[model samples]
Target: MRLRNKPWAKEEMSKYPHIVIPNPKECKGNWNKVFGNNQPIYVEVGTGKGQFLSGMGKLYPNINFIGIEKYDSVLVTALERIKETKQENVKFLNEDVENLLEFFADNEIERLFINFTDPWPKKRHEKRRLTSEGFLRLYEQVLKPGGDIHFKTDNQGLFEYSLHSFSKYGMILNNVSLDLHQSDIEGNVMTEYEEKFSKKNMRIYRCEAVYRD
Candidate 1:
């Protein structure tokens, strides 16, 4: 799934040099000091090519952003963009989101974003999905009380399932949108996956869920 013609992506990626870590043990329990003073940190679970992460990092200099993407192929671009901006407010992690708590301290994050995460549509594979209850607990353990989970996806079934998951976890849902682009919310940045899916006229689902605990 190489996107060679994306010159903008290439140019943006060329700006930042990446520091890839193979050992999750290295980042474990050290992220609190990485971004300097906590600084209202936010993380995107699967930041493909870093489109959303880099975009937001540039816009919000006060809030530190971390793009947690396990795939090197996609993360390379994201790393380059952060370097280009000379943005000190962001970092990229090439690792699975499954063990997120090991890398972050308790209630370390202020917000979590799951932009078009893998749906794992098969009934038998439901638990493996990122929005599953098990994964939500990982998020809950790190997100501060009253912190929010903002998610967007074109997958109807995943969106529906996630709604139930959020409610089941005692998270309040607000600002629900069945069609995001048509909404009046300004500066709603589009991720790489979002742009591709929207071309087919797929309805986008977005919501904010507050972590009660």
Candidate 2:
């Protein structure tokens, strides 16, 4: 994705100190302390423009939601949304998921959401896929034992690849849905991309994967 450079993006993000955590690396394992609560912590990798995370913070006030987006330009949009809503339980991280350990300790996160992450379809780029074993290993290190991953994607090739990857990595899959919009599940929050694709009559695949001892 070619990110448009927003010269004032970083400056704008700094204005929302409550939403955009300052020096997130310092919070590290002490995330509960950052939120001032022991409630479960949930993070959305590749949060995009923050539609999902923002809605989740409102839906589950008890759960702390962090939006991780590598590009400042894209993240600033999320921060602005949070700023407008004045949502207290949400935070934003402008960094790559590869360095997740640098800001969070083992068992620090209770749940993770990978919503419409890039497919990275090339065979040589398999490792770049978030559901790949390489990324799953990283998730295992930071997520608490038995922590779950809620993943949704519209790409069939990526969805199939993720199912096999999760199975190979020994993750227990549940709530599998080949066409989420047609499913009977309740409380399904739609992302910007999800709304756009669903309008096109696209099938949205979704599942939950858990780490078991």
Candidate 3:
């Protein structure tokens, strides 16, 4: 399903008013100005409810973060989360990820994050999955060469499918974890979905995919 419009809903965030982008279109190819001189920009493509990005922005002040969500209703929740922190290092785009090239210059984004994206389980609907080859091409356009996309999901099927898709695109994978919560990495930020499904004993698969030059 395509997402509708409502830039004001997010634009009106008052608490962490700094997080709200005055004009997202202006940041196009000029994101560096938002983060000061030169800082790494990390993007969360489907930042549902903003739990992860908000927490991450608070934790890493030097790294600039942007959340891209097509759905306005869901993005409002994330906007509200950042409100509590007043983190200036965070921003968002209430737009589809398909227009990534328009929002950013080639090789602009340093890192990408895909967290518990819609699986698009049906074989006929495979193209709808964010990890599809066509979508991966869009990622490559915005992601800096040698840059990486980190993915986390509780769906085994999507993880398996994404693993194949990454390989098909000649991307390199490392630090792949079948069960993320069980790993030794401390202080891992958990999203609302990750916290909910993990209690049900579902295995969480995570991996970092680096696009080859």
Candidate 4:
């Protein structure tokens, strides 16, 4: 989906410095200070529209939720949603996922979420996949030992590829589901994309993969 540019997005984001962290890199390793607590941080890599992040924050009040999105226009909507939810534990970073390490210290994050991310289906672009070996290495570097990656996607190809990628990286896979909505899993938080896909009766694949200690 082509993102429509919101002319007011930048100004709107600036007004919410506490929620839309302007200088995320400066908070590196001191994220707990940013949230004013030492709660474990759970990061969502492509936190589009903030639905999942805000929802997760509402459910897990003791955990800090940070969403990373590169586009300001897209992130502004998420910021609004978080504000409406009145969730103080959730925050947004208008930054790219590639710079994850720059804003986080080793073992800073307790878990990671990759919800309905771009499939990058072309075989040549496999490296760009969030679950690809290269990205997994980045996740490993910043994640605490035993930190797990929770992934969900509607694309079967990406799901299959991710399973193989995680296996190849020697990560342990658990709670793998070919059809998430149809599964018995409880407490599922839906993203904007996930809700749309599920309404269309599309199968949603989900899994949790953890790095070995």
Pick the TM-score winner.
4
Ranking by lDDT: 4, 2, 3, 1
What are the TM-scores, per candidate, against the unseen true structure?
0.86, 0.97, 0.90, 0.98
lDDT of 1: 0.80
lDDT of 4 by residue, 121-192 (tens): 888988888889999999999999999999999999999999999999999999999999999999999999
Clashes of 2: 0
| Candidate 3 segments exceeding 4 Å error | 1-18
Could you tell me which 10 consecutive residues in candidate 1 have the lowest summed lDDT? Answer: 13-22
Q: For candidate 3, which ten residues in a row score worst on lDDT? A: 9-18
Q: Where is model 2 more than 4 Å wrong at Cα?
A: none
Error of 1 at 71 (Å): 1.0
Q: Report, for all candidates in order, the number of backbone clashes.
A: 5, 0, 0, 0
Better of 1 and 3 by TM-score: 3
Residues 1-213 of candidate 1 have per-residue lDDT tens digits of 454554354344444433333454565556656655657889889888878987898889889888788666677777766666777887877778987976787787889999998899899998888888899889988888888999999988999999998999888999889899888667788898888888988789999898875
For residue 17, model 2's alpha carbon misses the true position, in angstroms, by: 2.3
lDDT of 2 at 151: 97
Candidate 3 lDDT tens digits, 1-213: 345565666546533434655457667888998767588999999887899998888888899999988776778878877667777788877788887887888888999999999999999999988899998999898888898998999999999999999999899999889898888756678888898988898888999899987
Q: Which candidate leads the pack in lDDT? A: 4
> What does candidate 4 score in Cα RMSD to the true structure?
0.7
TM-score of 3: 0.90
Q: Model 2, poorest ten-residue lDDT window?
A: 13-22
- C-alpha lDDT values of all predictions: 0.80, 0.91, 0.84, 0.94
